[model samples]
Structure formats: structure tokens, C-alpha cells
Target: MHEFSLVKSLLRQVNEIAEQHGATCVEEVKIEIGPLTGVEKILVQEAFELLSPDLPGSDCRLTIIEVPLQAICNSCGKSIVVQNFQFQCTACGSSNIRITSGDAFRLLDVTIDTELTTGVTEP
Candidate 1:
């Protein structure tokens, strides 16, 4: 499944981020996915479960946020949420519409655990 590749890429990104911050452990990774993204949530989860263990912080948790497909009606000049993948404008009943969001997979944020050090001075 394509989800495997996507999840692999995601883990790679997370690994890079964790390294950049000198994180001891990766705690969580959050992502936003929409219907238009053509990505199945369950498949992505499975892929992550299978592939994440090979990378650092194998215990990292993945959070998937579902967002609705949003678009702006060029005919009515109204912003609306597209339902049933219909490209027509609800208010004007026109086919002229511009998609605004919910079209791609987006990485929201990553949470990591880091080590903190404090220097002590002895007089």
C-alpha cells in the first residue's frame, strides 16, 4: 500500500526533527489528513506500527486529525465545506469553485523528550 511509503517518509521526518532538537525520545507525532488526500488512516497507522520500530523512539505515538474538504465558491463568493465530493457550489449551484483546504496530508507537530542539564557551582 502507498500508506507504507507515506508512513516511512513521515517517520524519517520525525527522526530528523528529533535529532535536530537533540531529543532523547520521540513522544508524539501529529498529522492532518483529509478525504481528498486519498490516504487511508487505518493503513497509515498499520504502516507506522510496522516501520517505526526500526527508527529511534519506537514508542512514538501517531495522532491523526481528520479535516473536512473546504472550498470557496467562485460564483457565490462563499466559503463552504464540500460534501460528498461534489464540486458544485451549494449557494449558487455553480460548478465554479476553488478548493481551499483538506486536499493534502500535512504534518502538524512533533513532541519529543529531551534531557536538561543544570550546571552546579562549588565555591
Candidate 2:
């Protein structure tokens, strides 16, 4: 599935960030996937779980946050919380709408463990 590719890319980026910070290991990875992005949660989770150990995210926990679609009705000028893929406006029953969010796949944050440095000189 394409989820594998996405996870691979995500891990690559995470590795880069961890390396830049002199991290010895990654603690956690937080990401948000919107409904419209078409990235299946189960597949992504599976991929991440299987691949995390081999990547820089060894012993890291992957958190996937599902984001709901938010849209605004163009005709009625009303905000709508879309559920069950319903694109129509509930207040005005209009199909003219613009999606404000929920169509994204983003890496929110990463926690890494850096080497413990001591200023004392070993004699």
C-alpha cells in the first residue's frame, strides 16, 4: 500500500531531525492525518510499527491523530463540521462549500533523546 511509502518518508524526516539534534534515539513521533488525505489509519499504524525499529525511531512510539473535516458553506456562510463524508451544508442544505481543513498529512512533533553531556573532564 502507499501507506508504506508515506511512513518511510516520515521516518526519513524524523531521522534527519534526530541526527541534527545529536539524538541517540527517538522517543515518540506525533502526526496528524486528515480524512480527505486518504491515508488509512490502520495501514499507517501497521507500517510505522513494523518499520520503526529498523529506522531511527527505534523504541519510539507513533501517535496518529485523526483529524475531522471542517468546511464552510459558501451559500449560507455557515461553518460546518463534516462527518461521514457529508459535504452538504446542514443549515442551508447547499452543496457549495469550501473545505478549511482535514485534508492534510503532517508530522506534528518528535521527541528525541540526546547524549548526556558532562562538562567535567575525565582525569
Which one is best on TM-score?
Answer: 1
Residues 51-123, model 2: lDDT tens digits: 8996553678999888789899999999998889988998999999999888988999999877668765556
Q: Which lDDT tens digits does candidate 1 get at residues 3-120?
A: 8888888888888888998888888889999989999999998898888786566677889999999999988899988999988888888899998889888899998877776665
How many clashes does each candidate structure show, in the order listed? 0, 0
Displacement of residue 32 (Cα, Å) in model 1 is 0.5
Give candidate 1 regions above 4 Å deviation. Answer: 118-123
Per-residue lDDT, model 2, residue 106, is: 91
What TM value does model 1 have? 0.90
Error of 2 at 89 (Å): 1.8
Clash pairs detected, candidate 1:
none
Winner by lDDT: 2
Task: Please give each candidate's TM-score.
Answer: 0.90, 0.84
